[model samples]
Target: MLNKIKKQGFLNRISSLIIVQVIFVFAALFLIIFNYSTEGSVSKQINEVGKYQTISNEISGYLEDNISSLTTDNLRYEYIEGELASYDEILKAEILTTDKDNKLTPIFSYINSVQSVTNEIPQTYIESIAEHMISEFNKSNLKSQFAPIIYNTNNIINLLPLKNNQKTEAVLVIVSNHDFIISNRSELSYAIFLLFLIATLFSLLTVYLIFNRFKWPLNKLIYGFKKTARGELYELMEPEGDVELRALTSAFNEMSKTLWENSTQLKKSNDELEESNYLLSESRSYFKTLIEQSPDSIVVTNFSGNITFYNDKAGKLFGYKKDEIIEQHIDKFFTQPVMNTINNTDNELNGVELLAKTLDEELIPVYCIASSIEDDKSNDIAFLFIIRDISESKDFQEMMIRVDRYYTRGEMAGDIAHEINNYLAVLSGNLELMPLFMKKGQNEKIVSKLELMRKTVDNIARFANGLMDPNQDEAVFEEADINQLIENVLAFLKPQNRFDGVQINTDLSTDLPLVEFDISQLQQLIINLVYNSAEAMQQIEKEKVINIYTQPGNEGDGTVRVIICDNGPGVQSDKKEILFKKRFTTKRKGHGIGLVTCQKIIEVHSGDIGYEYDEGAKFFFDIPLKQKSKEKISEEEKASTVYGN
Candidate 1:
């Protein structure tokens, strides 16, 4: 029973209590109604009897006041019939006289309404009621102030004695039936019962409406709390109800909002912390691998030039054990001037030629690059030195550097001559046609030819000056819009005869963020790729279409990808692997330095380039939004002493 009660809902419990109370209240009310109904019915019956008594008294008074009328039976009969027939409750009216030998005689009689014609009431009932009323009348002691006597049976009878000068006389009697009294009591009982039934139905409907008012909002709050428990936090709706219930809902909404805000802030903090830790661990692992696995001797020292870290290569290069190298002054390995130069300068020392000493006091030629490693606050924490022994290969490296530089300059000059000769051919042809147009008196054609020749000459001069400049070798990194660069290259190239029949299509993503690159190198890269594609399609029969696309890199990698493809015969499969190598080209007059230079330019920017054959030659590259920290120097730069690394 207790379990069942506990399982019941709140509304069910409230309804049960209210229903029990209602039943008790209505039961008491029903009793009161029943008592009131009974009293009302009794009062009505009394009123009915009183009306009959009034009729009986009036008949007796009339007979007594007119003694002459009582002396004749005719006069008495006339009076009783005419005056007493009007009362409906009075079933019958009669005057009876007692003669000698005590026998009763009916002097005058009249029956009222239904009973006069019907025998529904037995004749004995009326006779018995009349006798009882007369006995009550005769037993009265005060005859002058005589009152009527009432005898009640299935009908009521009233008796009033008629007297003259203190002598016994006829008695006036009235009979009334019980029809109106019985029916009225029954109707009152039914009305009371019907009223009770209506009250009960109305009470039940009120309970239902009240229960729903509380149940709906409580149910919504319960569902909201359940969701919160499952980590899906949300606010609850404020509903209309009792004040206490509304207050509870308001409190829940406030608490939920607070909890959600705190949870979101905590989650964000955790994510940022985790990302920081991961980057730190990755950075540590990366530096550790580069220092330990690097072919050059890596040495780390404090700002005071005291060695703090020595790798395996460093120990072998200096001919010392690991214990012998720790805490040693860098001047013990290199000359004092080397330490002085590194400490006094703010810039990195790249490929600084110096003599390094061994444990046995012998000196050897070595190339060293030194830089300061700083903390997050930009405070210098340590100095890093990468030293490569050049004892055996110094002369060979110098020769190779000269050969490489000469070859590169020769290739650049060849490419320049090829580009210039194409423009010069256009200039020569226009110069040859200028006189003919002038002789024909076509000034418009002549002016157009002259303009073309002038533009071509100006383009050659600008191109030669930019390409021949020595400072162009060093890349200038800046924030550049990639799509704008492609557009600029296309604008410059489309006016040239090499791309006259070529259709160039560009699909650049508008939302691409700025990428850190060398603008001049990027423009040169585009021009070279476009020129290569145009040359590859010189003999293709199909429409020469080149597609250039720029878009963001893979999601969250913080890079951008660029693609340039042409509908031309792609490179031979056997030659694809060597496509970016120096002096490797299939063009009849090509020096093949363009693709190699493109590769080097991208490499210096810490980006990767690739080529693939997809219906044609497709060249693509991925460049980061920001360049990574330089971990090592390139072989070419390491060949001899170089500065400003």
Candidate 2:
């Protein structure tokens, strides 16, 4: 049954058994060797200490025995008086001496002195005993030795006197060789060497047995793990070694099997994800291409109004290149007033908006939609702007508005003219009747009344004629000398009732070029400007003047400039840009269309009208010279022939 269980590979029975036996053998051998070695060393040290103590006690006993033989009260008095001088002879006769010429010969003299019965013993005996005592001292041998005593060397012994009262006592000394202690140490050292050899041999055997039992199984498991990590399920790991190690290996093998199975499924999922990403990228590219090829202007911007992308149409509309406009703020394209409104609104200007003017001063209206674009993380990354330029549409609408205004004004003027004319005709008819009905005496009052009525009718007819003249028809372009035109305009306005209190100054440049313009319209434009100047200067009490000038401009462009300036209050700073817009009047009773009509007339002639508000209001217009063509001359001749008829 045990063999069957071991073959089943559930646990590494042989490896566990070998490991346990190896550990038990190594530990038991190590402990036994260590205990024996320690005990031997301690026993050696104790034996050496005991030998030293015995040597010390034996030396003390020898000294006491010798000193007891020498000390006597009568002998001490004789030694002090230097009587019985042969101390060596007396010591030799009283005691057994080992060597007669030994280093302790002086100790015999001291003993002889203490043994004397006479009042004196010789100083030679005392000196000899003292010399022997010192020769036997332990320090005598140590003083001559440079190394500690080994088994071959003699153990040194020292004798020292114990003084009692005034008497000098003798001391004995002994010396023994340490050969016996050395022999015992050698035996103990041999035993320790043998035990160490056995332990080393046992440890090597145990390691060999354990390695032989487990090395094959561990290598197989490692190889299996590496193959599993590489996605190669080549083989299943076979359990080896103890039960715990077999269980661990089984778990690891199962985990690797599961991982290998999941890896295949994961690869399929990754393939799908990659395909989705590719399709998304392709879709983005297609949309981008479509936007780039679009004819209508398209721009994408951030919430801060910074343009992120723009199409070619956008570049043309804004008069900027794609690279130049991208990353630039949208506010950079707006005029000051519009920019202020946009900034104040926090870039959320809604409804169909118009830019009013492009970079090149061309009127461009844009209908735009602004929407926020967020990322997958739901973060507001940017804004998308889609715009359409409506300049042509706006121009058509403006034309329609102007035509409407004209028809409405014309109708009102016609009605007023008709009523005034009827009243004038009635007054004229009454004036004629008054002349017929009056007698000579009543004729004075009737004639005076008729004269007053005729004057009122004449004034009424003049007012109606002025009102009936169509200013729009007079704005047709014709070839005329600009200098003569300006002088005529000033002359016409100088005598007007409105100019009574305003001083006029004229400086017309000679040799001016001819321009194609409507003479009546130019005159009206000048009249309006002068009238505005007069009104502006109404508050001035002194030196209220209007200066009119004409000059040739640079570039030999055949250009003529008409300037009308006044020493009047200048245009308000904030209203300067809108001064020519329809219905944007600053006066209570004045229609703002006067300056707007002037601008329109100048625009139709392919000229420009501008103003400088610094140091009072200065209005100016410049017209380019118009060259006559052969076709125009032919048309003029045909008209002349018909008129001649």
**The best candidate in terms of TM-score:** 2
Which candidate leads in lDDT? 1
TM-score of candidate 1 relative to the true fold: 0.30
C-alpha-based local distance difference test score of model 1: 0.71
lDDT string for model 2 (83-183, tens) is 22332222212211234454333233223434323333344553455455544443343322111122232332223332223222333222222322333
Minimum summed lDDT over a 10-residue window in model 2 is located at 87-96
The models' CA-based lDDT, in order, is 0.71, 0.58
- List ranges where model 2 is wrong by over 4 Å: 1-11, 18-475, 480-500, 504-514, 518-524, 550-556, 571-603, 608-616, 627-645
**Candidate 1 RMSD to the real structure:** 29.6
lDDT of 2 at 210: 53
1-645, model 1: which lDDT tens digit per residue? 887445655456566757765775676576665566457656765775466556555666666656555676577667668776666656676677677754467777776656642335455655565555556656666553333333433565555567655544666665555543343445655666666766676567667646675767778878878888999876666655544456678888898998899889988999998999999999988988888889899998997888999998888888888788789888889754566887668836877778788886656668899999899999988898999987446352333333433454454565556677889899989888888898899999998888888899887765643442233455567887888778766755665667779999999999998888877667666777887899999999889999999999999999899999998998889888876643366689875667766776677677889999999999998888986534344454565456545
CA shift of 259, model 1, Å: 99
How displaced is residue 68 in candidate 1, in Å?
99
